[model samples]
Target: HTPGYGSAAKYIGSITKEVIRDGLVYDQQNVTLLEIMGRNAGWLTGAAALAKCEDCEGPDMIFLPEIPFDVENFMKKVEELHKRKKSVVVAISEGVKMADGRYVCELTGTIDYVDAFGHRQLTGTARYLAEKISREVGCKTRAIEFNSLQRCASHIVSRVDITEAFQVGGAAVKAAFEGETGKMIILKRVSDDPYICVTDIYDVHKVANVEKKVPREWINEAGDYVTEEFVSYIKPLIQAELTPIMVDGLPRHLYYTDVEQKQSR
Candidate 1:
């Protein structure tokens, strides 16, 4: 797993719990669609399952890009859930594709901008799906996109992730100082019980542009949720929180200002 993934997963998991609670406040039938960031991998979307616990049932369903999405089946599931309960929460990766290999969001015809890397700027996925559910399932719907918040939620960052990030950076610098080239620093998990990890340098050629997807067994047989093993693997990463130093009701940050630079000069 990448350094930032742990932090992102932490945020995603916490938010999922909060959303699940909020969804239950109303007595009417409602469906909430949470669109998480993931282009080809569903690691972040899978994190939503971490919200499951005794108090909360978590998301009723989770869809990942690793599996082809069936819109009809998804609708049927939501309708069935509505019959049993008032609120239905579903987490879906923004990159979920149909059997025809087209992104589910593409069906909305709202994606026109493409990045330089030939990747479509994926957004409005939750909105599109929420609208569909509201229309077809006839339930009140909400579309929530975690968006850039997932990446910049430093206030809720995991302490382990931050420490590992610094360690990985230091490892890279140490490697460069030792005349190493064309290599990348990667974290190797030494153990899971105590959650120990160490940084090691690997050939960049072999590591770069490689996508490590969530294992098939990590997902349930129905492909609507993640398994216990997946939860166990991620729980350790999001264990400890690094509370930000707050000043005047806001988190204080360290930075070099122009005045400081001029004074030094």
Candidate 2:
């Protein structure tokens, strides 16, 4: 996992719990769709399960990019849940695909825009599904996309992730000073009980361009949600929170302009 993943997971988990609470405000039946970012991995989407606790029942279903999505099955599940509950929350990855290997968002229309890496600008997955559920199930539906907020939400950053990020950078510098080349620093989990992580250097060539996906065993047999083991693995990463420095009423952040002005002074 990457340094920023832990912070993003924390934000997702916290927001999912809040959304679940908001969904139950009314007596009417409603389906809330949370669209999480995951091009090929489901780590962020799975984090929604972290919201599950004694007080809060997490999302009713979680769809990941690793699994081939079935629209019929999804609709059936939603209908069943709607019949029993007043509110149904679902967490879905933007990159989730049909068995035919086409993105769920592409079903609405063609995505003309593509990034430099040839990846489509994946969006509207939640909106399309929400509309479909409303029309088919005849109930209220809402689509919530976290978008860039998932990655840039510095206000709720994890202390563990922040500290490890610094450690990784320092380790890289140390390795370079020791005449090491073509090396990348990686976090090695030495202990799970204490959640101790240590930095180790690996060949950059071997690490580059390799996508580490969530293991198949981590997902449930139904492929609709993650397992308890998955939650246990991520729980440590988001254990501690880093409080932001507030100025007046907002969190204070350093900008490049401020640095330039200080240098001039």
Candidate 3:
């Protein structure tokens, strides 16, 4: 499972506190801005909405790729909020596209790169919007991308996610050991009360390269946010604290030091 969902929520909370700490007053006129990860799936963006709700008890604005994006409509929404509120925090997903069916970032005509898996590399959709909005709205606009940093973070791993990951990995090993060939591990949620998950192996061909997306019901009708029900379903998974190793009164992280050098013959 991609940890991007939990990471998205964590960064949204971080940004909210950062804005408040930086004295970005929230009345009815200003907006706090952020960008999160997602390609075709809005899972990360939806998690950001959940994070925002958990951090602040006010209405927020979010933009996602699930709905056809309209820049003018977006600006209009911001303007409407600015008229009544001193501060507005808008969360946008990186893959968001315009009504004209173009990405604001695509104007750079940037040469795209792909990983071994052949997924297109993405960068800087937030910077484009922030620049555009700053020029058009005449407001202090700050765009922040919680990009790869989300995936790199282990400190914020959802206990549920970590546990699930470990279990899945173990399940994979067990499946292989049992002579169950060509299978991948999957999790089935049995109940929410105890937050139970059952790990089972699935045919590898059935799930490889297939993407599961956040359902429309999981998102608010405005296409910008997630519902409380969605949050409830996700919240327990992220619960439980991870213990950190301390060194000089700060958490310590370990890195590999042993390395083998190739000898030139």
Candidate 4:
């Protein structure tokens, strides 16, 4: 996971809890599909599991891009969950694709172009799944994408994430100044209990152009949800919240635009 990912994941967990609270307002059964953005790793979407603390049920199912999307099985899974709970929340990574390598959104004829890196720009995975499930299961379905909100929601930022992010940037700059030209800065776990971590420098040649998929063992056999092992792994990163300063009735943000405009004059 990248430096900003922990904060984004923390944002996702907070929002998922809010969505679940909103969805269960009425006595009627409902399905809320949250489309989380993560290029390939389900690390961001996996934050849904973090919401399953003592008071929250969290997402009933989490679909990661690591596993191939199966339509029929997904429909069945939603149906079963709907029968048991009035509110069934599903978290899906936008990059989730079918076994045949076609994105789930592609089935609906939504065309997306590839980037210079040949990565498909994906969106609308939740909407596609919502429409499909609403037709088959005949349930009240709502779909929402976190989009840019996940990255910019500074109000609910994780303190752990922000600290690590700051350290990584400084460490990278130091490494460069010391003539570590081909090195990339990465966090290596120092301790899990006290949750200590240290930044390590790695060869950019070995780390660049490589994508790490969530380990197959991290996902359960059903392929619908992540194992507790995965839950334990991500929970610590989202441990503490960093509350943003309040201005008037809303949270204040530090934006570069205003500063840039002032400097230009």
Candidate 3 lDDT, 64-136, residue by residue in tens: 6777777778788887776766666777777777778776567656738878888766667777767777788
- Local distance difference test scores for all models: 0.90, 0.94, 0.68, 0.86
lDDT of 2 by residue, 132-251 (tens): 999999999999999999999999999999999999999999999999998889999999898999999999999886768889999999999999999999999997888999999899
Model 3 CA deviation exceeding 4 Å by range: 1-8, 11-17, 20-30, 52-55, 254-265
**Residue 14 displacement in candidate 1 (angstroms):** 0.7
Encode model 4's per-residue lDDT on 1-265: one tens digit a residue.
5787778888898899889889889889889999998867888888888888888888889999999999888988889888889988999999898999988877767666888888767888899889888898888899999999999888887888889999999999998888888788998887778778889898889987788888889898888888888877777788788887898989987777987999989
Tens-place lDDT per residue, model 1, 45-118, is 99999889887888999998888899888888888998999888999999999899999989889899988767
- TM-score (C-alpha, index-matched) for candidate 1: 0.95
Positional deviation of residue 103's Cα in model 4 after best superposition, in angstroms: 1.0
What's the candidate order when arranged by decreasing TM-score? 1, 2, 4, 3
The numbered model that scores best in TM-score is 1
Q: What is the C-alpha RMSD of each candidate to the true structure, in Å?
A: 1.5, 1.8, 4.0, 2.4
| Cα-based lDDT at residue 97, candidate 4 | 86
Error of 4 at 131 (Å): 0.7
- What's the TM-score of every candidate structure? 0.95, 0.95, 0.84, 0.92
Which stretches in model 2 have alpha-carbon errors above 4 Å? 256-265
TM-score of 3: 0.84
